[model samples]
Target: MELSQEELRKKFTDLSQNPFQQTKFSRNTKIRKIIKEFANFSQEKLRLENKAVKIAGRIINRIRRFGELTFADLADQSGVVQLKVVRNKDFARVSSGDIIGITGKICKTDLQEEKNKQELSIEIEEFIVLAKCQQTLPDTAHYKLKDTEERFRKRYLDLLVNTENRDILITRHKIIQSIRQFLDQKEFIEIETPILVSEASGAQAKPFITRHNKLHRDFHLRIATEIPLKKLLVGGFEKVYEIGRIFRNEGIDARHNPEFTTIEVYQAYENSEHMMNLTEKLLHYLAKEILKKEEFEFNSHNISLKENFRKMSMIAAIKEHINLDFSQVNNLEQALELAKKHNLRLEKFQKSIGQVILAFFEEYVEKKLVQPTFIYDYPIEVSPLAKNKAENKDIADRFELYIGGLEFANGYSELNDPIEQKKRFEEQTKQKELGNEEIASFDKEFLEALEYGMPPAGGLGIGIDRLIMLFTEQNSIKEVIAFPQLKSKTEEK
Candidate 1:
C-alpha cells in the first residue's frame, strides 16, 4: 500500500522518529528478491499473505472500496502492482506518495475494463511505514514534462514516471552494444583518446574552452576523435575505433548537441568506397540484431534494409532535387540567389559557393532523402581532411549517409599529405580570422604525425544517439539521452 506524505509524517511523529532520515536499505535489490520469491511461490499456488515481507514503494494512486476490497496502486522501478487493503484497520496510515510496504497474498485478477487482461494483486494482511515522503508529487495522469529545461534538471523523476522515456534510453544502450559487437566481429580494436588537449584539431568545429588551475594555462576540449584515431593507424593498428564523447561549442537542436557521443573508426589501406560498404553492413547488421527486423517506419516513411541504398554525387543531388544547374551557379552571387529562391536562411558572412550549396542541401535535399542514401564527392573547400577525387579535382572523396531525412554517418578517404594538410590548415586559419567559428584550427602535432608516413586509410563517424533514436522511433534526441544539457535556473529571466 502507498502512503501520503502527511500520513507518513504523522506516523513518524507518533513513533518519535524523523521521517526524512536516509536509510541503508537498497530498494532495487530488495524488490528484485521479493519478485523472485513471489514468482517461485506463485508456481505452486501457495498463499503469500503471511509469508511475504513488507514490500515498499511510492503510492501511485488510491481507489475507493469496490464490492468488498479497497484498491491502491503502488509502483517501483521493477513494475506496478495493485494492492487490496482491508477496511477499518489503520487505513488512515496510508496516503499517496508515501513509502509503505504491505505483506499480502499474491493473486491474479481479471481486469476486464483495463487494457491488460490479467493483473497482479496483493491481498494486504499487514503493513509497515518504511520511510515518510515529505513532498507532494505532481499528478501523473496528465503529466506535463513540457519544459525541456526542467526535464533535464529532473531526469530521474521523468524516467520514474514515464515508461516510454526509460525505454528509449535502454534502447540506446542496446544500439551501442550492437555497434561494438559489429565492429569487434570486423576485427576493430576499441581505443581511448585524451579529452584535454593542448591543440584541438581534426574537424571544423569550435571547441569548448577550459582552464587548468595547476598549469596556469588555457586548454580546449577535443572537438573530434579524428586526429588521434589516425595517429593510432600510424602506430600500426590496422583497425581501431573509439566510441567517446566529443565536445563542440555549437548551437543545440534536435540533431545537434554541445557534447555528444561519436564512433570513429579507421581502417588501414582502404579507401572511402570500402568504408561505404562497411558502413552499410554495420548499420544493417545493427538494425537486424538489435531490433530483430530489417523494416521500420520513421515519421511516416517506410525504410527497408533489404533494398540497396541510393548513391548520388553532391552536384547530381542538387540538380535533381533543387532543379538548378550547378555548372552555371559556380560563384557566390549565383549560389546566394538560388538559396534565396529555395527560402534557405543564409548569413551575410556565409555568402560562399560551398556554404550556399550546403544551405540548399539542408533546405531541399535532406528532407526528401527518406531512404538510406550516400551523397558523395563534396566540394573541396568544405572538406579539408578528405582526399581529393582522382577524376574530379574540385570534389573530395567524402560521403554522408542519410536515412529517414537525417545524416547517420560520414566517411571519407583520409588526406595523408603533410604539405597539402598544412596548406588546408592555413586556409582554415584564414576563415577563422573571418569569424567562421567552425573552421578547423592548425595543430602542429597532427601535421608532424602526418609527416611520419601514415598509411592510406578510410575513416568514418556515426552519431550514436541519433542512430538509437532511429531504431527506437523517437523524434527528439533528448528522448534517447538519459541526461541532456539544460540551462541553469539562474539563467532564466
Candidate 2:
C-alpha cells in the first residue's frame, strides 16, 4: 500500500529523530571485496562460513516478502550483494533506495536450483537504517532514466539508476590513472599551474574572465596549460606536465565544452618529433596495455593504434583531399581567389595565404582523417605559439593527432627565441584589430620568461575529455563529462 504524504513525512521524521545505533557497521567490508575474498558462492565451495560480516549499502530493490522471510539487494560503490533477513519488522519498514547497515554471514540460498544455479546471500542478524529514502522508487521494470537532458541535469539519479553510465565514469577514472602511471614511468614530473592568469596567451582560443576583488583587475581562466608549463621549462625543469581543467569561452557542441580537461607535457631538449613519438607511445600503451585492444570502433570507423600513425603536412593533406596544391599559390590574391572558388569564408585578417590554407584544411581534410594520423606543419597564421619550420617559414613545426575525424592531441616544436615569440604575440594582437576576434594577448611576462634562455623544448597538449570519449566510445562530449554545462532555463525557451 502507498503511504500518504503526511504518513511518509512522519515516518521519516521519526526515523531521523530516533535512528538506531550503527556502531557495528563502522568496519563494514565493501561488497566487492567481500565477494572477492570468498571467491565461490557455489554450494561446493562455500569456503569458511564461520566469520560474521558487517556490510552497509542502500537497498536498491523492492524488499521481497514471503511470509516472514525478506530478501533485498544491497548496493555500494564496489558493487551489489544480496541480503536475506527473516522475521524482522525493522526490515519491513525499509523501502528501495533506503541505506541500511546489516550484520550478516555468507550462506547458500535455500531456494532450489534453477538450471543448476543457486545463489549465495547474506543472512542478516542485526540491522540499522543509516538513512531513509523518503520518496518511493520507480518500479524496477521501468527504472531507466530515458531523457537525455534529464539524465545530464539530474546526474546523481542517472548514476544511481543506470549502472552502465556509472561504469563509464569508473572507466574514465581508470584511464586517468593509467595515464599518470604511463607518464610517471617515463620520468615526467606532474606540476600544477594556475587556473586564473593575467593573460590567456596559451592557445588561439577565447577565455572565461572573472574579476579579482583585491587586485581590482580582471583575470582569465586558462584556455590551455601551454604557457605556464612552458615557463616551467624556463624555470629549469627538464620534463614537466600538468593535468588540469582548461576553460574556453566557446560554442558548446558534440566535441566542445566550456570547461574541459587537458594534459600538457613539455620535455626540454626535445623537438616536435620527440613529442610526436611520446604521444604515439602513450596512446599505444593505453590501447595495448590498459584497454587491451589494438582496434576500437568510434564514429563508425575502426581506428587502429597498432601501427606507427601516418604523418602528413597540412598542404599535403589539402592536396590529397581537395586536389588543390597550396604550394603553387604564390600570392595573397591567389589564396583569396582559391577561397572564393571553394566558397570558404575569410575574414579581413584571414586573407593571408597561411589562413587560407588552414580554412581549406578544416573544410576538406579533417573528416577524411578517420584513422590514426599525425597532420603536421600547420599554417603559421593559425599557430602563433608553435615554432615555424626552418625550411618553410610559412608553416609551423606542429602536429595534431586525429582519430575518427576528431582531433585528439596537438604537439609542436617550441619557439625558444624571445624575439620571434615576441613578434608572434605582437602579430596576434594586430590580427585581433583586423577582425580576428580570437587571438592571444601580448604576454610581456611570458616573453620575459622566454628571454631567460629557456631550453628548446617540445610541448604536447591532449584533451583528456576527448580522449576519454574516444576510449569509452561515446559520441557526445556530454556523455563522458560528469556535469557538462547546459542551456540556462531562460535560453531553453
Which candidate has the top score in TM-score?
2
Report the Cα lDDT for candidate 1. Answer: 0.79
Model 1 RMSD in angstroms: 4.4
For candidate 1, write residues 236-282 as lDDT tens digits. Answer: 89899999999999887777788999899999999999999999998
- Residues 1-493 of candidate 2 have per-residue lDDT tens digits of 5678998777766563334344445745888887787647565566354558888888986778889888899988888888988898867677888888888887766665476665668889987887767666655446788988888898888888887888889888988898999999989999999998999888888888999999899999988888899888888899999999999899998999899999999999999999999999999888866579988889888888878999998889999988999889999999999888889887788868888888888887899999889999998878888888999898899999989999999999998899998888888888899876678778999999988988989999999999988888899998899899998768877
Output the number of the lDDT-best candidate: 2
Pairs that clash in candidate 1: 3-95, 3-98, 4-95
Lowest lDDT 10-mer window, candidate 2? 16-25
State the weakest 10-residue window (summed lDDT) of model 1.
22-31
Residue 218 in candidate 2 has what lDDT? 100
Per-model root-mean-square deviation over C-alphas = 4.4, 2.4
